[model samples]
Target chain A: MSAIAIGLTGVTKSYGDKVVVDRLSFTVASGECFGLLGPNGVGKSTIARMVLGMASADAGNITVLGEPVPGRARLARMRIGVVPQFDNLDLEFTVRENLLVFGRYFGMSAHQIEAVTPSLLEFARLENKTNARVAELSGGMKRRLTIARALINDPQLLVMDEPTTGLDPHARHLIWERLRSLLARGKTILLTTHFMEEAERLCDRLCVLEQGRKIAEGRPHTLIDEQIGCQVIEIYGGNPHELGALIRPYAQRIDVSGETLFCYAPDPERVRGQLRGHTGLRFLQRPPNLEDVFLRLTGREMKD
Target chain B: MWGRYAAALPANAWNWIAVWRRNYLAWRKVALASVLGNAAEPMSSLFGLGLGLGAMLGRVDGTSYIAFLAAGMVATSAMISATFETIHAAFARMHHQRTWEAVLCTQLTLGDILLGEVAWAASKAFLAGAAITIVAAILGYAAWPSILYALPAIALTGLTFASLAMVVAALSPSYDYFVFYQTLVLTPMLFLSGAVFPVTQLPDAFQQVGRFLPLAHSIDLIRPAMLGRPAGSVGLHIGVICMYAVLPFFLSAALFRRRLMR
Candidate 1:
């Protein structure tokens, strides 16, 4: 087999009595995109931190860039870039200055850093924002600029934690397009996000975790196929609390939420009869998707 | 492997240089205030206490008050540099900028980053001391040979305090802790550490007690050097100053490492 860019064995982490990442093992091959799928509070960020050497694991081993990950991991961290969940951009510095300063952290000369900055700005579509202070940029602009900053070192492995979060649909798709383009060029990427659609669109393979434990693992389509089947019948109106009594006889599982009920079954069409006599109800059927699979694995209840 | 580590020093230094640039711009008001405030305290003390008290008191070990106060002022500048650098500037880097965290993400280790910070802060402290000394000389209060030794003496004090302040910053959970140190620790030490009055003026217990404080030893080294007088007992002073310099750095490095590990 060819070399793996990242390798891990039973990596574990905990805070006080609360375990954040529990005995997890996985690896990302060189020149491939790997998605880390998990619900909020499932230790996805914890794993990412361990990989970055930001946090040391309480147990187990890992290797990154052919070295023991987070231990003897000698690959210059300057050769890796991280897009944190929250923007840590220097507000005082202009977009270009931010990149320049970050480059200096790796000992890059001013001449070397400046020469590469323009192309990174253009790649993130923020070329016009070269002189603008980071604080003046909008959220989408900031995110894009962060992506550009991540590429300044020409990183071998890029780690993104919730990159598209808190963005409009147009911005999200633009990010997706940029990410796909990166993958096409054969860069190794590790991604973590709350949005399932992003994972389905970008990940080659993913593992889902909940409360610090791995719950499911596979490609998005395969996980959806195994957990949520091919069809879903969504019913809205009526007292959703009574949905179990109304739809349980016909559906495989009845998920009562707010004024809507999710009837997850092998055939959505066959479940329409259970709701036929129901009063004050509207219903629709759609194909199975990554969102359904995620909700099923992590529960559809409101998460604060 | 060590080549990469060595290469990262300049990288780490660059981060501090960038921070220094931004800090100078963002806190220009504070910098101007530091320049003025740092200079003013010494000058005013020289005029008020040194001149006023010296006219009445006659002499300290037989030197006039204006002359005596100028020597004290040189020591004061060292204290001010250490105070401003360790408390105000260091606090902002830890709390506002999160500058160290960003720098550590590179190939640079924590040790290089600390050294860079200490270097920059020490440079600033030395500048303030040198500026005050120039003013003292213009007023004809300085002795030339003592002035020659003033730089090394004050520079050491600057490192001592910068390292000490870094420990304070690394260990403190908030900016309030810095204020607490300035008031409770730094202020008393400044007055009691032989800056204004000679430790000889104090009672017997206070005189011997003075030897233990890092600032006292720093004062012992800086004052006599600025006055062209012999610095008493070189070995003890250097030993005490070096202790002041190294202890806090070890503590701060350990603390920073603990925080980063989390």
Candidate 2:
């Protein structure tokens, strides 16, 4: 394996009495997209903050780009770019000015920033909105500009926190495409998101975190195959308990919710055959996804 | 706790210049309007109190009330400008705009941001003070070349108030919280600091209180220079201003680092 771009060992962080990040350990290899997937209040952003040295870990060590965090974080940050979850763009400046100013924060000169800004704007498809104020731009445009701003210093590691959370499908796809290009260019990425599909699409390897603990870690597909199965059979309506009992014989695992029974099996046809005579129940069988793995590990409960 | 805070402060002082430049670039967009807005208050106070009140009150000490008030206005304007910038504007950048958060993600530390903000606020206050000083000079209320000597005093006043206000900004949860500081602290400081009236005329208790207030020392240094008179205990006034400027700066930097790094 290539050298680790980011390494966290038994890292723990807490706010007062509540532990935000438990003793978690993970590594992101160089030139790969790594995802930290979890639900809200599961300490995804907190972990990202620790890596960036915005917040200190209560215990354990974090090394980014081979430098100890919180101590040499400023040196590490010079090679790392960050896109926070919210739009913290300088609304006081125009789109281009924001990039220029952000570059200066990294100690980049005006000439250096100017040389790369045009190409970056082109990459983000924001060439036309160069003179537009941040508030004047659409939600997608602001997000794109923020991404472009992050790249202004030509950072080796890109740390993004839910880059596409509030974006529309079109905007999300654009960001995803841009991220793929960055990956192709060998930029190491550390991404955090609750969106399972985003992880499945982008991450070469991922870890599922639940309430500050890492429950599972592996490639997306491998995690799904191990935690869940190759296929999921979701049977809706009509006596969930009875249906669960019927499907239990053929399925590897079974889960019961309010009106639905989810049966995970290596072979969908075997589960389908078992439910052949169940005319009163509505059933759907499809390939198990990361969502199924997430649901299985984290449970299907809403988090505020 | 002090050791941790000391560690959190920036090792390099020059790093704050970038943050100062960032603010300057943003302000450059509305340069004219911002300058005019900053100047209007002290300008109006100069005319209103210096002329209208001057007509009724006549001379203060050895100099005319307009001349005395002009010098005091220089310090008061710096205080007001710095207070508003650090309290309201810094609060917005820190919380609403999240500009400081973005800056913090880079190589700059919280200390850099704090110093940069204080520097920027002081710069704005200096401009406001200089403008009113020029107006006072044109109105014949200031001694021509001697009044220019008050620039350093005005700058120090700016730093003192900006640093003091930053402590408040670090603690403030919302915009409304500033009202308490403005009314309870700033309003009292303005009146007691001999900005609008003579400090000696105040009661012995208020006079004793004024001695500790930064603005009182600021006006004492500036009032004499603007009137072409000998400044009394110049070193003492400058030392007091320096203490206010330096101590609150470290205090506020520590406060901001604690607030931000958590």
Candidate 3:
């Protein structure tokens, strides 16, 4: 087994009376892609901060890259790269200058930064925009540049917080492609995202977080099969309460949400057969995925 | 609590220098425009008030009135330049640009970033103070080599003001909040500190309050040097300015630790 890149034991954090992270414990092995899935204000960002030693944990210990956090965190940070949620690229500098300045933050010499600039730009697919100002770049281009800047230190582990949020589908696809390349290169990655599809596509193993606690932890497909089932039959436009009752006997589990009845079953044909004769019932049948598992574990409530 | 943060700063100078270098590089892009902009207001005030008002007031302290006002302008320029840099420019980096957040993700600590920012603002203050001194020297209103003595005094004055304004930057939530600091604190301090005229000319009550102002001590040190006179209470003046510089730095650092780290 590979060594652990990140490890936490009974970590807890609270602000005033509100406990942000409560007894959270997990580990990501070296060269593996690990995802932290949670809704807003569930303390995903707070966990990222604690692991980086940017914030202190009220209880328990955190180790990253074999160094104790909030103690030797500075030394650990030297071998780690981070892509924060928001774009904080130096708006004053050009594309090359942004990378150059970021490298200096890690104490890398200008000569060393310049030597890697050409390849780094190519990695982000920003070769043509080398001299362009960051403000002039598109949203996707800025996000890519942020990723490239994080790699300036040649770090062993990459910690990214929602690295692809707010991007269009095409842009998101490109980011995922770049991330896959990094994983192939044997770099450990810790990613946080609200997008379950992103977690499913990229993360080798992942954990679901709710109210500062780990609710589920496993491979995406395994969690889907174990926690949910083989298929989900969505029925809309009919009375959700009556339809939920009618399909309950055939489904492994049934959930009614705002004029829609979600029926989870091992076989889609069984649930579909029960809904066929129902008048004015709109239905969609697809294989059970991570979102079903995620929503089932964390619920579909809107969160801040 | 303050000692913990003070000890957190790296013993090596290179990290803070890197932070300084980042700001220098960004400032270099607009060096000409920025330098000219800082020089304009003080230069105009020096010419407008010094030449115009000096004609009516004449000499009060055994030198020409314009010569006296020139020294005060140097101190005032340093104060305004450093204050603006910290409150406006540094506030933008902390709040709007989120530059400090990016830097914190690296190996550098919050103490390192704060030192770098304070150093950079002090550098800007030095330039602004030096520009006015040079102009005053060129115009023959300031002593030849004696004004050289005022250069270090101007730098200390810069450090003092920059350190003080950083506290305001830490407390402020927006650009609009800075106005309260400027109007209520900086403006009154300017008038009371004898930048425009002699402190003795004011009422006894105002003079007592002026004794506590950092700018007053700065002017006391700088005015004598610029006039080519033997300055009195040299150790006391330096001590006061140093106190202002050191104490506020710790205060601001503590405030920023609460603001950013949480």
Q: Best by lDDT, which number? A: 3
Candidate 1 regions with alpha-carbon error over 4 angstroms? A74-76, A299-304, B1-34
Q: Ranking under lDDT, best-scoring first?
A: 3, 2, 1
Error of 1 at B237 (Å): 2.3
Lowest lDDT 10-residue stretch of candidate 3 chain B = B2-11
DockQ of each candidate, alpha-carbon based: 0.40, 0.62, 0.58
Q: What is the lDDT of residue B38 in candidate 2?
A: 85
The better candidate by DockQ, 2 or 3, is 2
Model 3 over residues B42-141: C-alpha lDDT tens digits?
A: 9899889988998999886788888888888899999999999999888888897999899988988877887888889889999999999988888888
Interface RMSD of each: 5.0, 2.7, 2.9
lDDT of 3: 0.88
Per-prediction fnat: 0.39, 0.66, 0.66
lDDT of 1 by residue, A206-298 (tens): 888888777787878888888877577888877766765756666777665667777776766667776677788888788888877777777
